[model samples]
Target: MEFKFTAEEEKFRVELREFLTKELPDGWTGGGEEEGDDWDFELEMRKKLADKGWLTMAWPEEYGGSGASHMMQLVFAEEMAYQRAPGRDQFGTKMLAPTLMIHGTEEQKREYLPPIARGEVQWCQGYSEPESGSDLASLQTRAVEDGDDFVVNGTKIWTSNAHHADHVMVLTRTDPDAPKHRGISFLLADMKQPGVEVRPIINMANNHSFNMVVFDDVRVPKRNLVGELNRGWYVGATLLDFERSGVEYSAGTKRTLEELIQFCKDNSRNGRRLIDDPKISRKLADLTVKTEISRLISYQIAWMQSAGLVPNKESSMGKSFGTELQQAVARAGMEILGLYGQLEPDSKHSPLQGRIEQSYMMSVSATIAAGTSEIQRNIIATRGLGLPR
Candidate 1:
């Protein structure tokens, strides 16, 4: 298979890099501790990306997209991750929009897709509950049909970015008796209403990205139901497939590795550069090889998607390997930095702006989010290898 990018794709990459360099603020190193306080700046940047038709470039033109190719989409994702841009809403643009395009009704599409493509609306996912994280089919969130709405009740835990969301894509049980996975439905619930409450769930990194959202008799219009009633499990599966298949994690890991290598080259220990240490050089080389492998896996998934194939087992494998590698890189960073790695991002003496420290904490959640490593392995074993459950 041809792994190299075409000339046009390379040109697209260069153009994106130039745009990012010109648009991003001076002294910006991609991440910061003040992300939550920069809401206005985030909105402005998102709007800029939207105006350029880069937010949903892979989507069809009727949906406010540029109808760009999958290779362009890969290029965009990699560049965004490398630069650590803060604009693209993962829920609205990445997970929800594609799912809606595939399964949403015409009315639903007209109402939602445009605003998302314009980067005017932000969405949060409501899937995992207190009891149903890994085994999501056991989610207790219930939505009973009213006159023209569905009254939703229950809670969703580990919801990312609910505090800034305009809407929530909630997975609820519409029929409790019709089997665990068969009775579910996906609903677009407005977050401004009184029935919905969001509480922050601070992680070990002390970040406020995660939230616990409670829905108390939340009224959702029946028109907002995505796909068919009691058939959302299929839709959710497709969305997960999209979520798991991406080049961003690998790209981010590669950037981190490059930064770490630079740090090693510049720093010294006992009058010798860290890069000169045989042990450090070997570790860095090992990580470099693994990062390249992860990149290839991501490209393979993208290629499969471009060919109109659903990469079920392949997506799971990519997610599992990429996340695990991320954690490994974080661990290696901590080891390489020694006591300095424990310093928080805001610490004056911390290296790489304490990015390694923050990553070490954030990496703990990567293995569990989207789908756990165990679950991905199960998919690989049963679906890919034809092994017994």
Candidate 2:
């Protein structure tokens, strides 16, 4: 099937590119990762996006969004990833807002979503407990009822942006005796409350983006419960689907590939230009074709959403393929850069500011986070192909 952006959509892409050029300062390449320290700058860029209606472009008009089509949303995401801009909040705008729209009460939506669309509040996900990364329903976090609040106690690992989050969307076991999935409830809690502690966990690349969040007597208002009690498994499942949607993967890969190509052309190895080598040329060609396929797969998921159909295993397909391809591209970059690739960004001799080295480190976790590759394949097999365990 043929696929192309509408003329207006293409124009929006051009306008967005121009806007990014004018708004961003010199040499800004951050894509909103590891940004807690410079949160003021991040907030500034996020509000600019909000003003442009780009932060919540796909949200409905009432929620301060332009109600752009999903395809337009796809284009916007692609451009944002390509430019490596720092304004978008995937947690609030991409994950939580959509969940609230579908499962939240009127009061909940009113209180939580507008600030997100305006880029005024920061949110962190409180899933992925110490024992419940992939087996999320098995989380041990307890939320006991007490008057108007549920007193919470647990620790959540790998809680991204928790240090900078103003609030968190957490999954708690409200009924420990019920079946693992049946007893869970989704709750929103203020991060600044008593008994909440955030400890940073710097990755190998030395970026302090992930954290471990500890909650002791963190009281969530009873009214903060999302959807029906003990049914948040389904609600959280919906949010997970949104999380795995993979447009940013291919777009980021495209950026890396472009830079790698340019690097090959501009530099030399073994007394010759790297791009002229037969093996390097072939590798780049293969990655180019695979990147296009990955891009198309992600686009298909967005198209399915636009058609009002849930993507299910299709999301897994895009995520797995696109993420693995990211590793492949980074590996190829290291091969071309050779020993120099090992240098960190701080090293004066490091190539490409050591982005390839960091990409290599970050890509290892890409296949593991959100959900693992093994888990994704299980989903594809059981859901998409109708295979049984």
Candidate 1 structure quality by residue, lDDT tens digits, 78-132: 9988788888888888888888888999888889999998889889999999989
Relative to the unseen true structure, what is the C-alpha lDDT of residue 352 in candidate 2, on a scale of 0 to 100?
83
CA lDDT, candidate 1, residue 63: 86
Q: What shift in Å separates residue 180 of candidate 1 from its native position after superposition?
A: 0.7
lDDT at residue 288 of model 2 (Cα atoms)? 95
- lDDT by residue for model 2 (1-389), tens: 78878999999999999998998877876543344547777889898888878888878888788889888989888998888878778999888888888899989988898899888999999999888988889999999999999999999999999988999999999999999999999999999999999999988888999999999989999999999898889889888888888589899999989899999999987799999999999999999999999999989999888887667798889889989999999999999899999998889999888889989988988898888899999999999999998
Give the C-alpha lDDT of model 1.
0.90
Worst 10 residues of 2 by lDDT: 28-37
